[model samples]
Target: MNAVTELLAGWMPGQRWFGGKGREWADVTAEGFLLDQSDPVLSVHRVRVTYKDGATETYLVPLSWRESPVEELSSAFIGAVADPHGGENYAYDAMRDRDATVPWLTHLVAASTVGPMRFHPAGVAYIPEGLPGDILSTEQSNTSLVYGETAILKLFRRLEPGLNPDVEVHDALRQTENPHIAPLLGYVEIDNGPGEEASTVAMLQAFVPNASDGWRLATSSVRDLYAEGDLHADEVGGDFAGESERLGEATASVHRDLTRVLPTEPAERDWYRSLAEQMTSRLEAALAVVPDLAEHADGLRRLYAAVADTDEPVVRQRVHGDLHLGQVLRTASGWIVLDFEGEPARPLAARRELDTPLRDVAGMLRSFDYAARHMLVEQPGDPQRSYRAQEWAERNRQAFWAGYSAASDLQLSAGSALLRAFEADKAVYECVYEARNRPHWLMIPLSSLSRLTSLV
Candidate 1:
């Protein structure tokens, strides 16, 4: 048991599947496990642990413990040889184990194919008929194991309480016939406890595959547009007008469905205003480092304050709370929205709050800048070519706004100022995001902020 604990504790810290930040492993307490017929060879252990980064939680780590620690095994674990008294163990990432993951995913699908939920070492798995099958990236908020072409099993990580909104909203919208989102194919609905009051700990739904994430596709478009020659922007195949309109239409359709099936109320003026204020503060805080932005700060502030104060048809209802180019997928059929789960950085309660539809629109519009600017720097050329690329980005940015506004109910009316305000606010937030993680990409939002007052 002690050898098992040491090997697992070291292995877990380096795993993408492990939830905790694995700076240093600590307090590796073995809570429980399912020992297989092959001793520790095929085993699942439940360990409660605290890390050097000050996080404490319980996690399930499956190990391929060996009778003789072999260096020939996978790098995910270190091999431990037998010492005098007992068996020595080595470490390895359980997910990399073919015997473990492949079997685990298969067992999960079989369990989901049956009556209800199945709890195996692989986590909660779900199955629906006719959906595409694949395993989603482990870096995300949940572990998704798709069963065929009809169903998706999402096993939650960083587990939360109650019915997860990703499952609930999609299911409700499916029942209401909403087309903007991927429809649900039922769920596993694990309670984690025997009582009915316990929250759903797992989910299964319709699988969406063969779709290019909008972010990547959009960046490709921007790259083509930002190429060294003026011919780049003129190329309709590279231009983004068609997709922008389709995406806008999708957003509008989603909003219309919300209006019909979901609840809406008067918009919260103070909240929008405060959020705008925060955007301003963040911009100021970041602008201090950029220095080139100080000239435009006052202008941005006035525009932001004005837009935040608009009192028009402010309706609040369910929305794709964390919409962005990254959140959408372009399919052969059309665009498919993925993951109703809100911003993972935000708390569940805050994510569930009803906000203006423009909030979503703003997230997407901000992504336009990211798409355009990210590629602008990628394309190296002479001064004239660089200027041409900047021009291309500008042209596409306008086209995107026009396409979205045409699909939406937004206008230049006094009440509709919130739309523009929110767009700027979104860009301001982007500046912070880019600064902390992608400093070279700061120009994207800076250019966007410069145009804050230009949008009618």
Candidate 2:
């Protein structure tokens, strides 16, 4: 192994964006590179790694190489490495190097084409020039850089060799003049090679200023309701039912736009059965990991079975594969959806699969339950607080459904069985996730399973 590859093997396992966490690295190799010849060279390298379990993943690593260490970027410093030109240089993540990143922004603004990469603005009248930039401090699955307050560019960390749905859906929504989503300002695409499909490396979108995360808003509302000693959820001054309803409407509107621009298919009987089977498989897998769920297994099975027995065909479209509160932003105008990339862990084909929009609805409903119950995890002994949490979740859930049904053709309220099945499936997925990642929070979803099954 070379100096850089050897250093990355140790560093990759600790990164939040690295997919191979908790796994032993069997091998790491540099697959491709895009290098800029300069004093502090800017390089984009694709690293392919194989784990001990025989699984493989590819990640994009952008680095800046300099002769001297940068004191301000000490935390980002990778290690000193011998340069091919017969000198030693220090390397750091290129995103933190303002000078190196400036050229990338310039390329986008000028709509420049270099080698196999294309940097062009889409659906925007003009590109802002010479704007100051900063990297967002919040850690995420991808790296994001904000150019002033006008736009944010998200660089995908894991390199998938196909069309990224975030760019795809945003471009389509921009075409329909959809206002509920951030307008796609521009994107960077690269041609892999002859006969290989081009990949979207990064995307730029209009940054919604003064926006609050949907998760924070919902949780804060729940906290307000819990604080009011004698008042019910609706009677409280910080009621989130109105905002939840608006969010539902926005979600439905985005779904309509996606259906209009993308190819959709009817959810026939065979598709329904396949979905139910997938749910059943997921539940069974969760049961193996979380034995506590075994008690509610039968109740969950009934809900999934009900969906398989339904003969009515539902409309399937390119809905958001993952639609939790964290994926939305509430601005002064309205709720704006972000990140159409779907579930990051799932394969590209599965994430892009056409499914009933209710799946997204179920995801949001589960998010509401999470937002309500998460605050009460530490105060478990208080029955009154738990009751209030449930009350808040139910009220907001109903209001959301009402707003969604009013705006869309589907009468989601009438399809309680399907909705319950989707919710149950989501909770099962959560149960597994919590069991593996956050064991203490496992009770939140376990309690949800009890409530959902008891209702059925």
Estimate every model's Cα lDDT from 0 to 1.
Answer: 0.62, 0.85
lDDT of 2: 0.85
lDDT of each residue in 1-456, candidate 2, tens digit only? 887888777677787888777778788897445556665688777788988889888888888888988898888888888878998899888877766666666778778777677887884655555674578887577988887778888988887778899988998888798889989888987777888887778888888889999999999999899889899999999999999999999998999889889988877788888888999999988888999999999999888888899765588889888999999999999999999999989987687778888889999999999999997878988999999999999999988888788888665565578888888898999999999999989989999899788866
Q: What's the true lDDT of residue 5 in model 1? A: 67
- With a 3 Å backbone cut-off (N, CA, C), the pairs that clash in candidate 2 are none
lDDT of 1 by residue, 1-456 (tens): 576666666666555656566246557776434333343355555566877777766555555655555554545465564656775655444444444444343444444322223432222224433333355564465566656665666655544445666766776676566566776644443334555433344555666768788888877776665453546565646677677778878877777676676677776778767767876787688686666567667777887677567556677777888888888888887777777777755666676778777788777867776666665555433466456556655565566566666666544342356766777767766767777778777777877776666654
Instruction: State the displacement of the C-alpha of residue 237, model 1, in Å, after optimal TM-score superposition.
Output: 2.7
Q: How close is candidate 2 to the true structure, as a TM-score?
A: 0.96
* Winning model by TM-score: 2
Native-referenced Cα lDDT, model 1: 0.62
